[model samples]
Target chain A: MATKSVAKKQVETPDGLTEIRWHGRGGQGAVTAAKMVAELALGQHKYFQAFPEYGPERSGAPIVAFTRVSDEPIQVYAGIEHPQIVVVLDPSLLSIVDVTKGAPDDAIVLVNSEMSPTELRKHYGLEGFRYYTIAATRIAVETIRRPIPNTPMVGALTRITGLFPIENVVNFLREDFGKKFPPKVVEGNINAITRSYEEVQGE
Target chain B: MATTDRDILAVTGNEATAEAMCQIDPDVVCAYPITPQTEVVQLYAQMVADGRVASEFVTVESEHSAMSAVIGSAAGGARTMTATSSQGFALMWEVLFVAASYRLPVVMTTVNRALSGPINIHCDHSDTMGGRDTGWVQLYGENHQEAYDNCIQSVRIAESMDVRLPTMHMYDGYVISGAIGPLQMLTKDEVQQFIGPYRSINPMLDTKKPVTVGPFDGLHGWYFEHKVAQNRAMDRALQVIQDVADEYAELSGRQYGLLDPYRLEDAEIAIVVVGSTAGTTRMTVDKLRARGVKAGMVRVRAFRPFPHEAFAQALQHVKVVGVMDRADSFGAMGGPVFLEIRAALYDCDPRPQVLPFIYGLGGRDIFPDNIEQAFAQLEDVAKSKKRASSERRYLNLRAD
Candidate 1:
């Protein structure tokens, strides 16, 4: 049976709320990235919600997570059918899932890809949405010594959307990661974020 | 409302409830690991190990043993608690009645999930709905904030001297349990003051006042009387629930009523629902209202001691009402919520035509359009002055 309602037409999201959907695989920090956006919103005195569309819990499986940031309290608990921003944490998911499904024509689609935005769009025959691309996986490997692209994707999303200042996110990550990880690991993630922020390409 | 000082934090429903549990710092928490609810136990155990709480965390073998241990601890004059979902809740079936009958205020967080034949771990109310008559006071929350608030208030409601019955607050499994949402939190000092000290009644550990618990109530025993008394406490609980909620509102600046009615006063058509679906329904109501439809919603926060009077009063003005239930009662008149609501409106002077809608079972999504269709049906019922059918209808269910 189909699990979600298929939107036949554009559904307007609630006023003053920015809805975002994240596409990634299990064990790739997509859920974590979704939650980090919420935490960033909390720091701005905005209300936020982040939740994953949970299927079977397994590594390497395709996963989707959602985040909503609003100036007012968020009351709706439905899955985001029309996200204003769609972030692709894994480039491999682009082939299997329509990451842009249900999003508006003007929605910002950010992907962690080595190709430039124009080249990536042409390569996939993508249209109608503004695309932003970054070598997020390469950046993560170079700085964080890992292949997880979620943090770098977050940095690119921040730069592409201009939701908040890059320095603020840096400070937030430092304080947040400082509590959980060692100094080296925190610094590595911070480097990965700033590098991705500077290298992301969009028109 | 008082201007209270509160900390706003981003946390999942499980994390929020765990924080509440830590703040309350009960004497003993006996729980086993179960999905959706496992995080509550895991987080609370971390707190206990980290010395953030003084509560004794007992890891039991199964949900049955978890409930059994909580009963024993609460009977022995300890403020006890537990958390479970779906199959875990089903496993606690037999011991649930014993905890309620013994009049122990054993507070529990039952993250609502579907019971399994095909072994699904998703959001549904079948688990809690199945235990509706288990004699436990049930409170449902729409999201993480309400779950946190309900968790804190449940202690006071359950431990009320006049109404000492076990309480279980529920939220949609995974939807709320694993979802991170912003919550305004009371400090540890504030929580401790709000709940006050735990008072133990007929303590088995008390040397001077010796009491026998779980005694054999044979054919000549006051078993029926005991049941009546239990029912009386449940009846008294309605008031206690309100009183505690009122007090909580004063301290937290967030108001809660037995029924949360939105735009229902002047509504021509309305929907009555529970849990996270209430949020989605509210959005639908807003959307329909924008298009000049007099749509409204009444979300039932308190399910057990099922707020019949409140429901009737809130929905009496509407011409048609649709009752949404996440769980179905096999071969019944309709779903549990629908039956209760239909019965509640029976004595109305101009009784509204109520329709039954079963939706979102086994974690099926009920989007805004589906709710709009329900409201459309209600409109049709209002225009024709006829019932849609004698059978229960479904939202977003596949016919094929």
Candidate 2:
């Protein structure tokens, strides 16, 4: 009777949803991460609700973004529990708030760290199911030369959790980066995403 | 039952309210959902996703953000709506007054659930009462159909341009919030034609056109003007209700405006109640009628700025009015509704001997049998000192 539970959607709602909780630093692109996920889901013609819950959390201070996605439309809008997946863009968050609390025991936890796959598993007690980490920060500093690993971590997030297709994530990066940044920045971001996906933990 | 309109569907009170909101067709809906009230927002979100409605569903973090988002959107000249109940409603207290004072025609549906200290999620008037003076026009709905119908009517009442104030459409939390029933609804085309496009007030957010709102520094006289204008706008809402109800009835073959009377035609004793509590009162009224007692019920529907004229007119022939309040105001009179009802009927010609009875707080099941029991307080007041209980009997709390 050990049937595998299918990968649950981060936001169950197309518009109103169950709830999605994000735990990341201010400059780590946590809020932007939630929005990108929202726009990505929207592009799939799925209904989604996404917003950030921030206090005076300055850069590197943990900020949260919540997304409630559902097929039937979501309404329980306090915070998230029973979240389908959790995107921890900053791997250092493991010592802070319990990111796993809102997640189901069988949920996916995608992190950005230089720790080896075996080292990550040994270092942290990920008891129930799937867990992942990618050296997204190093790639961002090396490739993008910007302290912003938001896009690279997003790549690791997609590669590890399978929440969005890798190809779709690339298209999203191209479009999102093209908005404010120049063409070179867009190419740099796309390059960072591709490199991060290859460097993601696991085989 | 007559053949239902396309927009008509037998749904819960909250769902009805949502359907009406959909009929009114808001441009933005941002909400942090609570039980009972959640369905209203959920239905709108569903409509947005399914292409049944085209509106920006601003999914928010809390009731605070939800209320704030709608305030900004409404101020920016878009019809906006949100829904919450009980604790959720209380949480939005910070921004509820903002929506009102800013004169944004924001339509919010509050499924009237009891406030929590003991943590109950049933029907009561306490939640809505907590929001009474937030400057929003508050209208109470009696049943599922009324909940569905009044939401449509309230939009016209609250957003008449002249009455560009927010409205909180109140329905009983679980009693009507979840109960499904038949309702007459307007056709989509008829609805669209009836409300037309929402023309926002002067000064929307445009870089080309600069405007300031809700600034910290406002002159004292300017504040007075805002209050006076808002008060006068509420007066315009009264007229808008009359016009919209007349128009909606014509297009959809259904009628609604202000108070709905069950009896009170040449009666001496009448019980007044609001929201789903009125349903129980009606059953008691029938029982009272069968017993050969000339007793009736007046379910107060329109509560904001109060239907002072309509209520005075309703109580014209009655000699005794039993006001059953679902919320206690600590030491003032009896219940939230009772105090307001008494205030409205104060200047009446030979005002009825009004008695206030407090019952149904914190989501307790209020039985129909208790309606007469509570109304009997009027007779008891006549016989002995009904004012002996320090104005509250603590029906749910300790009887002390």
Candidate 3:
């Protein structure tokens, strides 16, 4: 029998969704960061999706990943054409790729760099959006003892978007990291998140 | 609807499937690594190494060997499983039929990928669609949650007494397999209880009832009768698939069927699709519906035992139906799915004009705009009541 009783549950979020694009080089943990943000949203009972733009994945190659978060179940699997937020994990990618290619006028653009938001805007000739900057790699090196900027960038994004509280992200990271990493490594990541959250500078 | 207490886990489709496999904890799992699909077995291997599962993890040299090993284990009266994609699936083509013909209830996850010519490793339905005739019960999943659910249900469907055929559940490579999404998971205890225990039939391992498997069929042999019996099991699978889905719904609060129809009851135009694109098509249908367009979509969840009756009944009142296929059928009128859907509607009293759409080949993107365009074309056919071109239409293809 063709059963019509099992109607697919479609929850509609009144305010739509937040779509984010992450620009990073291969091996920089762009995909991991994208997934981390989505995972954080999942903890809040928000529907989320994260995926990388698949290609010949080689180290140092420019790559992009995306995340969509909504209060409703996300049904669209298409690539994000106009992202509400764009995160640049590697500052070098800014010159190579148009990281803000499809961003709207009011989109939030976050970058991992030592430059201030104004300096980044003028240096990269980037404009028409709220630009934020943080020395994520420096923070990661100081805390996590690694140059991987993904964790710090996640911190900056959490602070910039205020999507969830900083303490909530910290607690989530503590529990998540505790399961897989040694005590020192777990504390290092927590420090990276807290440090970046404090040091991130934006308008 | 009854609901099971579930935990929401954010994971990729591969992760979800591997998690289900950990829950199923079959007697044997033989696998070879391939792009996108590599993560599933890798995770499962970790489970096996961590002593989380009691299954023997066979690290085969190749996909052919992986399928061969699973068949051997299944024939030896063990619950066996495997996973593969693209070239790996092509390598297992011969053994795929062997497992099915031998009636070994070996469950597998065929992460859909485009077959290599230019040597691409990305999502497309080509690999599995190529093996559609290999006598395996095929199920397609639209997302990670469905992929997880289907992986669990596949064990029950394939191991069912009336439908003891090898089964493969497919999800788009990289799209679902590698992408992270939300999934509500069933506990390991619930899964074990749901699928029950592995029951051996005509066991080769049983000394009291030793049976020969894969015996050569000569001109005098019952090869023809055996083929007929296999087809009969496939016919029985249509019901068994539904019954399992019904029981799964009672346990999980999520329901599935042979076909997942959306807004098709009084539609003037509809599109039939499979895999991840179904979600995109559903969103498109909703967008069109908001503007008063009678748009509908039916996602083919089970492809091998094609639901002809359900399709005919669901799409009977529609004026035009568009069938979307991600893989081409070479010189055929359209894609494999289009051919089946058009044939399914052959007996309609007031036959609706069916159009063939071939899209997303070699992992090309199929946006909502592309699906919206297809619906617009269908709406045109419905309004004019004129036969559209029989030529296969291409979505999101460059015309230069």
Ranking by TM-score: 1, 3, 2
CA-based DockQ, model 3? 0.70
Candidate 3 lDDT, tens digit per residue, B1-400? 6554467889999999999999999999999999979999999999999999999999889999999999999999999999999999999999999999999999999999999899988888999999999999999999999999999999999999999999999999988998999888888999999999899898789998878988888999999899999999999999999999999998889999999999998899999999999999998998899999999999999999888898899998989999999998999999999999899999999998899999998899888889999999998888884688889989999989
Candidate 3 regions with alpha-carbon error over 4 angstroms = A1-14, B1-5
Question: What does candidate 2's lDDT look like per residue over B174-265, in tens digits?
Answer: 65675433455766776777777787776477657778878875565487777788788877777777687788777666677777787888
**DockQ, every prediction:** 0.78, 0.01, 0.70
lDDT of 2 by residue, A151-202 (tens): 8877776676555687887787787778888988888888888898888876
Q: Taking the tens digit of each residue's C-alpha lDDT, what string does model 1 give over B1-400?
A: 7554466888999999999999999999999989989999999999999999999999999999999999999999999999999999999999999999999999999999999978888988999999999999999999888999999999999999988999999999988999998788888999999999999999999989999999999999999999999999998988888999999999989889888999998999999999998988888888898999999999988888988988888988899899999999999988999999999999998988888999999999888889999999888888884566757889999989
* DockQ of predicted model 1: 0.78
Cα lDDT tens digits, model 1, A1-203, are: 11134334465877788999999988889999999999998888888999999985698899999999998888788788889999998888888999988887678889989999888867887766778999988999999999999889999998988877899899989999999999998999999999999999986
Which lDDT tens digits does candidate 3 get at residues A83-115? Answer: 889999999888889887766666789999999
- Indicate the residue-level lDDT of B371 in model 2: 67
Cα TM-score of candidate 3: 0.95
Runs of candidate 1 with Cα error greater than 4 angstroms are A1-10
Which candidate do you rate higher for DockQ, 2 or 3?
3
Report how closely model 2 matches the true complex, as a DockQ value: 0.01
